[model samples]
Target: MESIVSELEGTLVKDSDPFSYYMLVAFEASGIIRFALLLMLWPVTRLLDACGMGDCGLKLTIFVATAGLRVSEIESVARAVLPKFYMDDIDMEAWRVFSSCDKRVVVTKTPRVMVERFVKEHLRADEVIGSELVHDRQLVRPLPVIFHDGRLVKRPTPSTAILILLWIPFGITLAIIRIAIGVMLPMWAVPKLSRLFGGKVIVKGKPPPPTSGSGVLFVCTHRTLMDPVVLSSVLQRKIPAIKSELSNGDLVVCPEGTTCREPFLLRFSALFAELTDRIVPVAMNYRVGFFHATTARGWKGLDPIFFFMNPRPVYEVTFLNQLPHEATCSSGKSPHDVANYVQRILAATLGFECTNFTRKDKYRVLAGNDGIVSYTSSVGRIKKLVTGFKKVVSTFKPFIQ
Candidate 1:
């Protein structure tokens, strides 16, 4: 496999066309990775150029005869240069005005994208000298599994897959047992599960006295979908409108009022007002991996379940002191007010930036499916109505649990 990659590398550098200047650059990939790739390609490109293989180095390969290179053009170039491996992330349409043809293409890193401006202002550089930024990022994808396996042949790859196949059954059994325990006996399971995630699930501070003489209701601030589960609470129908009622002596463990991933807390549910005077604010944060589910940026694929599947996964949970009983909607404070107070405390505890946006706003941005119309048919009208309804519902709050 190294030989294949090595040969491919040789071909890319060794066979350059004489008429067109050829040089490789990356704008996005980290410096180390792109530099390594450039080192491999650059030297070979230069050596081939030295051998009169291409009129590359003779001309300012830094400058371009053309700009606005599109994906089709990139495909053509890669085919003529390195046919075996296809690079991704190029601008798809006839877009990506990398630089004007008259300007010199400056092969530089993104962190230094302002280099030209700096030089022109500070060093009195010539205004006529133009630079085109050559942005060829690191390999778009992971090195082919074959490159690592060194078999130069194909079959199963991904070292983790083999490990998973071997221990997956045990993992499944353990997961089922753990999840069941967490559901049935929360006090016993919360700590163990918390430890598995990363931090110990220990009582961080004093908890308030039970609202009812019979028991205490814990309200934790959630950071991920698993917050309820890890805290030994149910998942389905966890939250509805704030007005929903719960049977007396029913232990309601809700965090963040709603299930969302932003770092802020939502207003407290008033339904708990009558049920419990003792409201404990639990704060926990679930970290994201390579991909993220950050609403502030954009929706990413679910990451928590896969996170648990890792061999040595880590998670953490922390508990804040119980909110003052008066602050717990006990002193004529509205549920929303109590929730805001707890959110502020939890935000301080977790060092998270609280925002005003709610989960519905997040959902609308992720998918509305109403904008692209296929002529205004009854179906289209229905879709638009549904979209409008969702937007409306997102703005209002109801009293339910």
Candidate 2:
């Protein structure tokens, strides 16, 4: 067999610098606290790399990123988040040569988990020789990454890291001010007052005409937690927050169930379609200079705070035409069909692609488990600890004897 051997970092992938990659792992898998710790030690890692101890620096960086993290969490990030970034950095010429081989093997100093999935699945390599064991982008993933977790939407290079650290104080203050303005002022005055505080809400396409009887479901693209609030301000009326009791008055809902930063829309829940025939598809998008308001692994409560921390946070609300009576579930259409139709309409208006991916897919990829959190009993935990201890003691019996 004609076998091709290649290095992953610089041969197939153009940029060998792993700082940004490690930063991504640290932030996504662990949290901002871990990311901050890694950043604080970055200078030392860089110095080691510059002084002929590049491998040592790489080890140090990996240690910081993966230390104390569960294997599953790190693997989840490796499988989901890193591939997107890695594929973007692939060298076209190198890939051409690599793909032409009958038998392909790739080598990388990076941990096997990080590249294995990308290499074997995306690159179709026969074997991967890394520090541990196995391999693995395309803009189109071998596996789609519908869900990912992290607040830093932008890649964190050294400069970006420094800027984020510096901006935290100002960001916190600005977040508080933005929150205060929204809470204290009337909906009609929010857009006006927000401008003075560096907040921008651009409204396009007037709201759909009101309908009589039963509440109208405002189906919106999930951009951030602030979607309903922004829409409410634009409509100059209170739009009830999500996951609330449905009332006779109109309501807002993001069928996606999670915030998606990309221009693609996740599958809408059919439950919204069954809720009412009066549906107004809203295309919502946002722009932030420094931070994103969405996260998968991090605390979601802080999303609003991070969103307001940007220098000027912008939200564009485009209200599309209301769904016709014949196009809804009331007209004998399946709930799924109506939901998909509305999804396509909103995607077209925003110039985004419609995806069948949903919230469960998002959590499963970004996090190791399904989105549900199961609490273990304290007694069950102690039993597990005792069982583990017995196994360890049994293994040491020979040595002790």
Candidate 3:
């Protein structure tokens, strides 16, 4: 069998900038605290790299990013998030040659776990030789990463890193102020008050008047966590619009179940279609300069914080005609048919492409797990951490003795 030996990073990827991937692992696996620690140590890493000790710098970064994270958590990021970024950075010329070979081996100085999955899965390498994450050993995609979680949209190069380092303090203050305004003021008063802080909500197309008897189901295109909030601000009505529940007042549901940043609609779940025949399709979109309002891999609690932190965030809400009695599930249309019909209507209104991809597909590609949020009690997590720490301490005791 013809075998080929190759290197990763510069050899396979067009750009060798590893900071962004490291930033991702730091932010997704751990949290902002870890991410800040890594960013603070960037100067040290750069200094070490400049002194011709790049491997030392790499090791330092790996420890900062991966420390305290579970093996599974790190693996989740590698499997879901990193692959997309790596695939985007692949050097076409290098890939052409690498793929032509029958057997493939990849080598790199990066921690083996980081590159091994990307190498074997996407690059189809037979073996990866690289630096082991813990010991010393050996190491490693072109897939459009459609979904990813993080506040930062741009890759964290040295310059970007510096900007983020400077922005955090200001961002937090801005987020708090923005959140306070939303909380303190009424929905009708919010849009007006928001402008003082660089928030803008543009309303278009007259919203259908609220139906009198049965509750109306507002089917909205999911753009950000703020979709419903923004929609509510424009609505000006105080009628209760809860998620999933069909109230006598009104109900709001995003059938996509997850946010899609791009101008494409994930498959609409059919449950909303069967909820009620009184359906109103809502098209929503938003723009932000420095931060996004949605994530697939990171702590979702921060979605609104990052959203409100944007210096000038703009949201546009368009309301379309209500679904007629003939077009709803109540009129003998299958639930799936009604769902697809609403999806197409919203996609058309927003100029987005309708896709059959659902929430599971999004999370599977971006987070390496199902999109469901699992709750592990804080006590449970503390116990797990203590157990793992004891194992590590015991393992090193032999060397110390």
Q: Which candidate ranks first by lDDT, i.e. highest?
A: 2
Tens-digit lDDT track for model 3 on 1-401?
67798888788987665777888788767877887888888899889989999888888898898988898888777765676667768898998998888767787766677777677767777777876422222222333445655566666666776777688788889888877777666666777888988999888888877665567888989998677667666776543445434554666788898789877899999988777888889999999877878765434555777888887889999988889999997789999999989999899988988887876676556544433442223234435644554453332221111
Write down the lDDT of every candidate, Cα atoms only: 0.37, 0.76, 0.74
Name the regions of candidate 2 deviating beyond 4 angstroms.
Answer: 1-3, 29-37, 96-102, 135-144, 209-215, 241-247, 369-401
Measured by TM-score, the strongest candidate is 2
RMSD (Å) of each candidate, 1 decimal = 15.7, 11.1, 10.2
Off by over 4 Å in 1: 1-203, 207-214, 233-250, 253-258, 266-275, 288-304, 368-401
Q: Per-residue lDDT for 296 in model 1?
A: 20
TM-score of each: 0.41, 0.81, 0.76
Ranking by TM-score: 2, 3, 1
Expressed as tens digits, the lDDT of each residue in 1-401 for candidate 2 is: 57799999888989778788888888878777988999998999889978999889888898999989988777877866787777778898999888887778889888888888778767778788887644222222234344545667667888888788788899899888877777666566767888999999888998955444455778999998677767777877656644343454678889998778777899888888877777889999999988878665444456677889999999999988889999988789999999899999999999988998876666555544433441123234435644554453332232111
**TM-score result, candidate 1:** 0.41
How many clashes in each structure? 19, 6, 6
lDDT over C-alpha atoms for residue 97 of model 2: 86
